[model samples]
Target: MPTAAGHRAITTASMLTAEGGLELRPRLSEIPAHVGVIMDGNGRWAASRGLPRIEGHRRGLEALRETVRAAIDFGLDYLTVYSFSMENWNRPIEEVTDLMGLLKRFIRNDLKDLHKAGVKVRVIGARDNLKPDIRALLVEAEDMTRANTGLTLIVAFNYGSRQEIAAAARALAEDVLAGRVKASDIDETLLAQRLDTAGLPDPDLIIRTSGEQRLSNFLMWQAAYSEFVFLPMHWPDFDRRAFASALHVFSERERRFGGVTARGQADKVKS
Candidate 1:
């Protein structure tokens, strides 16, 4: 394992010091093709510190910026993060508005750095629900990174697995009705084509921060067989060393596609 110099303070489950200096290490050359993260525990993290929930959210956004750099350094091909969920709208109006404002600021301020690094930015979710300017900014970011060749960044904004599946089903039904595609041909591949992550590969690793155990309506269909890591650290608390540990864990796992069952070391006994 590489020495955790620049990344330890960021990703480790350590308490923040009086000084807000956190070091982030550059990513290794070997990164997963797809990595999914559920950015949870922001409000809880704030509550623990006896601070307002919005403060935690503000910190979470800063962590997200660090995450982008970690993803790039890791040499990951795709990085998907759970930023806002369909259920997040249930929070207080002030909080929701604050998050939207932060999102806008992120676009205006962060896009330049991302564009320079060749990272593509895309948001997955319904646009009708967000504010007009927020929606516009999202579109602008996507357009700016449409031609980027580095890691593809997917931000799940106002996204839900159930809603995505319903939309895909509706599109397939329409195609079948119009005689464009055969009803019998509506297999996994056909359904995938209609999903928000149509062209992207299925996520290989799904990490849920804040020690959450459930999927929480994340990429249910796409993460059918993804390796899962639930980190105890909150979203804002998660940093580069934490990401490195996750990668290290991922490297040690032996995946089984239902064909062979791993026993000890070299044994792949048929189930």
Candidate 2:
């Protein structure tokens, strides 16, 4: 775990910044390395079409497939999606069951293609409460794609950011009690290392569909400085074009973190 000085902010080549009124711009290749998405509005999409909610979810899967391919084509290294949340269990039992069935079917039907495409599967969520068969399927997906070197697909199934953070805290506390670590030594980097997304870089950009404007507990900590794009279309309508547009928006913005950029400095001087 590195201190703030040592924790270098992840940077892509050719990024634009405001410096002394000079336009500092990034190159076309300076795309985000990691992207997170809140796959929303599936039920709404289906309802509008006079179809079952499950149909929308099924269509959403198709959109997800396209997004995966698009991400790879765009040269992104990682993509995390909110597949399911712990709160989703509050839905009717039938809806929950349908979602679980969809999850099982998707993995069984798509795992081979994902492996063939060299995608690495990573599941980030609670597993103990899941049905045995579903848990087994998730494990199988991860094992089959473990060795692949291409895009890493993180599925946040049965996940909740607050729960994840609490779990990390508990783990750290246990470590302290066992004399494996000192409470005084805990820091952002150390705590992050204990998160489900330990090895992965924080998302540079997060996109939510159906015009939503909220985190919904998805990657709450990891998105501290992430740029967000809210799309009007539902998850099922997301496509390569929409993805490209989001990237374009990301490219046009400046990521200043906590400091004033050169442009800001210039503006202050002029004022």
Candidate 3:
């Protein structure tokens, strides 16, 4: 990442406004290294509009496509999305099938384009019960885009935070039982290494759409200090403006990571 003062002037193709007018934008500073999104409100959006739920999901895909491009243009290094979860299986079978179809379509249609744009796709989740074809598609996407060096998109499918932690603990327990590692040697870093997102940096910001304020069991361990931005718009309605607004707010915040700033310490003393 370059210094905050170093914004290269590029073509205005990606800086178009909602009205399609070109605009010169300042270079972004204080960009978060990793961002996580909880995509919500597809079903509610469809219900309110008296449309099939699938329509909202389809539109959400478009939003995701635009967001990926925006993240690239905005200089974000890593983006993680809560695509699907283990709890999602409890929904209607028809909806689950539709969701799975959408997932398949997204990979088949978008993988080539993403690879061309230098994006690497990584799926983090349990693969035990997925259909063989779904598993194959995921593996294909990862293998195909593994060598790219641009933005890393992490898709959390069939994932649950508690389950993720338990799996890591289980793996560590097995190692200890086998005498490969001692129980006393375990620590935060060692536990993190046993998780699926071992090599990836923790999220700097987490945004949830549809006005949700809770984490909904996503990235429990990885989001310890991540700043959160909850939006009233549905997932399908999230656009570049929304993304930029979140980043702007993030830039103004002072992240002390459980400590106080010099100003804060001075105020404390004065008080």
- Give lDDT tens digits, candidate 1, residues 24-80: 333454456888999999999999999999899989998888888988877778899
| Cα displacement (Å) at residue 250, model 1 | 1.0
Cα lDDT of model 3 by residue, 226-265, tens digit: 8899999999998887887777666656666677876678
| C-alpha RMSD by candidate, in order | 5.9, 6.9, 4.1
Worst 10 residues of 2 by lDDT: 1-10
Clashes per candidate (backbone, < 3 Å): 4, 8, 0
Off by over 4 Å in 2: 1-28, 266-271
Go through the candidates in order and give each one's C-alpha lDDT: 0.83, 0.87, 0.87
Off by over 4 Å in 3: 1-26, 266-271
Q: Cα lDDT for residue 2, model 1?
A: 25
**For model 2, what is the C-alpha lDDT against the true structure?**
0.87
Encode model 2's per-residue lDDT on 15-116: one tens digit a residue: 333453323222335467888999999999999999999999999999999999888877778999999999999988988999998898889899999999
Flag regions of model 1 displaced more than 4 Å: 1-29, 261-271
